[model samples]
Target: MTSPDDSLQLTATELRMATFRLARRLRCARAADSMSDAQLAVLADLRMNGRRTISTLAERERVTAPSMTNTINGLEEQGYVTRAVDEDDRRRVQVEITDAGAELVVETIRRRDVLLADMLADLDFTEDELTTLREASVLMRRVTDR
Candidate 1:
């Protein structure tokens, strides 16, 4: 009884809700107990995008420079990150992840993967459905990358 457009809208809404639920569930499996979500996000950003200035990180995270600075200060105190003067520009400081930060990211990812894999194993999805889910994940990444 629905138009094709209406069906697409319904599918999109359902997908969004499902993805949110899955993400929240995975958040509980995080390994970095001492890190706040914002701190962890900044660490993950550095790990993925390489070293960046505090201003750049602030813009990426949509927080004020001072707010980002405070977050960075806490992270530094925890020994998860360090700041160094940019070799090419003395005026700018680049925030870099420490070895401990990288290890935290790896452990967090491993925990999430294990949790998700166990949940998937408990599900009764067919191989074809699992393949479709994998394809959907790829498509979702491409959508967000734009």
Candidate 2:
């Protein structure tokens, strides 16, 4: 005796649960490998965008300036990142990933993909389902970009 509105709400909740579970699993797997999710995210950003200022990174990551500073300090200590003064403006500083940082990011990405592939292998998904999932991933990326 449920109404159409109830059915739609249930469907929306189910979708949200599925997304949460998948993201949680992926994050847990990544964490178990000794890399913090925040660090990996920052590394990925640097790889995609090259050098960036600390303020820009803080904004992009939706974190405060001090938090970004601490994160960058940790990465610097691990030799994964370095900061350099702007040649034209000594007051400005830019952060860049080192060779080791790039390598670590690539390795981490491969590991995550392998983990996801293993998980997906057991799912009884058809071709259409797979295609839909791929398209949904693209849309999800667009949503996150905002």
Candidate 3:
């Protein structure tokens, strides 16, 4: 009794809901691993992008300058990051992640991977299903990249 258009729309809606639920669950599981999400995000950014100014980091993180300052201060107190005056411009402070910070980023990524692997294992999905998921991930990344 249902038209093909209705069937297609229902399938699309289900896929969208499933993807949203999976992402939400994964984020929650990752958060439970250790560091707060903001701390982890900052560390990961520094590890990947090297040194940056407080203002730059604030812009990238979509936080206010004062909030970014506080975050950086906390990180420095924890010995995860260091701030030094730029040699060419003494007034400018550049923030860099220390070796310890990089280690934390690596550990965080490993924990997330473990969590995801466990979830994938429990799914009992076929190889085709995984390939489809992989393709969907690529599409999702492309959409975000814009």
Q: Pairing residues by index, what is the TM-score of model 3?
A: 0.80
How close is every model to the real structure, measured as TM-score? 0.91, 0.86, 0.80
lDDT of 3 by residue, 1-146 (tens): 98999998997798789878876766665422555677777888999999999999999999998999999988888888999999899999999999988988887677768888899989899999999989988977886667
> Candidate 2, overall lDDT?
0.86
- Cα deviation at 101, candidate 2, in Å, is 0.8
Q: Tell me the lDDT of model 3 at 141.
A: 83
Off by over 4 Å in 3: 1-24, 27-34
**lDDT at position 58, candidate 3:** 94
lDDT of 3: 0.84
The sequence of per-residue lDDT tens digits that candidate 2 reaches over residues 1-146 is 98999998997798789889987877765422666788888988999899998899999999999999999998899888999998888999999999988988887777778888888888978899989989988977886778
Candidate 3: give the clashing pairs.
none
State each candidate's clash count. 0, 0, 0
- C-alpha RMSD by candidate, in order: 1.5, 2.7, 3.8
lDDT of each: 0.92, 0.86, 0.84
Candidate ranking (TM-score, best to worst): 1, 2, 3
User: Which 10 successive residues of model 3 have the least lDDT summed?
Assistant: 26-35
